[model samples]
Target: METTAPIVDRWGGGTCPFDAGWKKVMMWSFIITDGLLFAGFLGGYGYARTMATVWPDQSTVFTLPFIAAMTFVLISSSATMASAVWSAQHGQRAVAVRYVWLTLVGAVLFLGMQAYEWTHLIEAGATLSGNPWGDALFGAYFFVTTGFHGSHVLIGAIVLLVLGINLARGRSTTENVEMAGLYWHFVDLVWVFIFTCFYLL
Candidate 1:
């Protein structure tokens, strides 16, 4: 068996041990694990939908145009997040702060839309304990998936706020900004799937 030696480089000439690159890798690993968990949940959702005597019509049960607008907001936020990362990397702190603010605004808007949707659904007689749409399965899946995604979005927003404060105080480094961006991007990616599966399909 062969052993590999640890790589080293001169100080300031190589990437720091706590660099953006390493943080991005860790974020990717986290996203991959999260994706697997979501996949299983979605598969189970699909199975339940198929097995149910009456599958809820997504188009009828969900407000399509409203969700579509929310989707657009999230996707645009992803773009802003990318710009923030770029600005941070290039040492443009002001631009980075602006982009982070925009991203945070987008997150707030998305959450508001989700709240509206939840309220509307409840008004229409959907409940976690007793589903009014099709069956208990319908309500169960609806709450579990959307609720999980909403929780992620909430966490992402909090992370963005923290990063924003750090940037404003000149305490945030490029690596910190990049790590936050990575987490934000993952949240957006998960929502894309959720929108497609829950609303469009």
Candidate 2:
């Protein structure tokens, strides 16, 4: 048997908590803070919906099948992003790049579908101020919530494009792909909330 002195001072400079890299820690921090921001948005939307004298019926306003397709595309992108990270970790740079590209394509397709949906709504007189539907706040909340989520998807697409290029050029690391995947997956998860709260409710 060997005797050892009691250890203290977990914050010793040389060690990382949970064995996570600085980049991963930072990404998680960003995800948490960003998630809070979305939570606030949804909270406000929920309160408004409950208080309104007349909330628009979601089914009458949206093409559920088309939105479901968009959701499917976004979820598929998350899977491709996970594949990219896995491939990068396994030293399959070419496969990683390909997966990243596939994920980007899915993001683009989702955005395009969103754009079409928005255009149709606007043409039907939906605006940030009001809509032909019931509650005026319906239009406002719908645009703001989905717009914020769409902007995140757009940013994820840009990041994936740059990541794919760097990966192909041998300038990207497994950690880089992993970070992008984390962000992309967060974007997808947020959409699930938005879809359920705004579209399905």
lDDT of each: 0.87, 0.92
Instruction: Report the number of the highest-lDDT candidate.
Output: 2
List candidate 1 stretches off by more than 4 Å. 1-21
**lDDT (Cα, 0-100) at 47 in candidate 2:** 96
117-175: candidate 2 lDDT, tens digit per residue: 99999999999999988999888888998999999999998999999899999998999
lDDT of 1 at 60: 80
lDDT of 2 at 18: 54
Residue-level lDDT tens digits of model 1 in 63-169 = 78898999999999999999999999999999999999999999999999999999998899888766556767888778888888889999999999999999989
Candidate 2 error regions (>4 Å): 1-9
Q: What TM-score fits each model?
A: 0.87, 0.94
